[model samples]
Target chain A: DTAVSQTPKYLVTQMGNDKSIKCEQNLGHDTMYWYKQDSKKFLKIMFSYNNKELIINETVPNRFSPKSPDKAHLNLHINSLELGDSAVYFCASSQGGQGGYTFGSGTRLTVV
Target chain B: EDKVVQSPLSLVVHEGDTVTLNCSYEVTNFRSLLWYKQEKKAPTFLFMLTSSGIEKKSGRLSSILDKKELSSILNITATQTGDSAIYLCAVINDYKLSFGAGTTVTVRA
Candidate 1:
């Protein structure tokens, strides 16, 4: 069984369109995070949720918002998607900010 | 900002060669350092180092953290073609991890 999983493995959309990538963890962790890996392979943390509470929000634009329905799920929603938003979005979960993250396979979003 | 820097950015070597990847960080209240090997899509966990001078080894890969120096290095010996991937180094702080611009390694057969 997969510990942390995300769906819509690949997302192809046109600019100005809005889309959402869903993530869920079955590891019974209390914290979940979203990271974006760009073309240069630089991984950057976008949002972090600990027990549905927003903790770390980097310098990401306002168009992106993360919602944690509960401790087990964190979803990323993007509005007015731009070309710069084309990157692989990774969903991760950890025990209590102490353990290493268990990451999902990733959702490669291609903004056309 | 917490910064994790990895270099040489990219490297090419033979299958049997030994390569050392470097990582340096400037993170406040750094607790640990992690290494991940990212291939096509996902990044798989490799190793995590916390104490200085203590080495963590798994198969042909090993890593050591120098907390006093704010740096760490990952060494791969007897490298194989399967070892080729983007090796990412992250500086783990209290709650978030700051990642570097990974090192792309190519092990030629």
Candidate 2:
């Protein structure tokens, strides 16, 4: 089984539309994170959840909210999306104190 | 704020040649430095270095970190076409992992 899995490998939506991406991990990791990769391939952390508690929020816009139903799943919801929101979103998970992370294939979001 | 910078944003090398990628970081509460190889999909872990001067090796890929300089180097020897990928360097500060812009390496056959 894939350690980390995400739904909707590709998404195309109109501006101002709302969409959601789902993620899950079966590695039994305690921490899960959301990262965005822009056109330049620069990956930036957006949010993190330890177990089910929100830990890091990197000044992301209010339109983007993350919800963790449980330790194994973290979902991202974006409302009123803009053209700048067109990027690849990745979901990753890691155990506490582990230096490496297991990443999902990523969802490529296109806003037109 | 934590900053991780990778040098030589991109490079092309012939098979059997050696390539070196550099990463410098500035962060507080440094925990560990990690190297990952990214192909068309998600990034995959390569090595993790905590103590300075200890080299971590896996096949043709190896990496070392220098805590004093706050830097790390990933070396790929006997490069093959399959070695072509974007190499990402990340620093773990406390519990957060911040990634660099990544170095794209293309190994030509």
Model 2, span A1-112: residue lDDT tens: 9899999999999999999999999999999999999999999999989988898999999999999999999999999999999999999999973566889999999999
Model 2 misplaced stretches (Cα beyond 4 Å): none
Q: Write the per-residue lDDT of candidate 1 for residues A1-54, one digit (tens) a residue.
A: 999999989999999999999999999999999999888878899999999999
Summarize candidate 2's per-residue lDDT along B1-109 as a digit string, tens digits. 8999998899999999999999999998898999999999899999989999999999999999998898999999999999999999998876678999999999999
CA shift of B37, model 2, Å:
0.6
Worst 10 residues of 2 chain B by lDDT: B90-99
Task: Give the clashing residue pairs of candidate 2, or none.
Answer: none
Candidate 2 residue A95 Cα shift, in angstroms, is 0.9
lDDT of 1 by residue, B1-109 (tens): 7789999999999999999999999988888899999998788999989899999999999999998898999999999999999999987787887899999999999
Q: Rate the local accuracy (lDDT) of all candidates.
A: 0.93, 0.94
Model 1 chain A is weakest, by summed lDDT over 10 consecutive residues, at A94-103
DockQ of model 2 vs. true complex: 0.74
TM-score of chain A of each: 0.98, 0.98
Q: Which portions of model 1 show Cα errors greater than 4 Å?
A: none
Interface RMSD against the true structure, candidate 2: 1.2
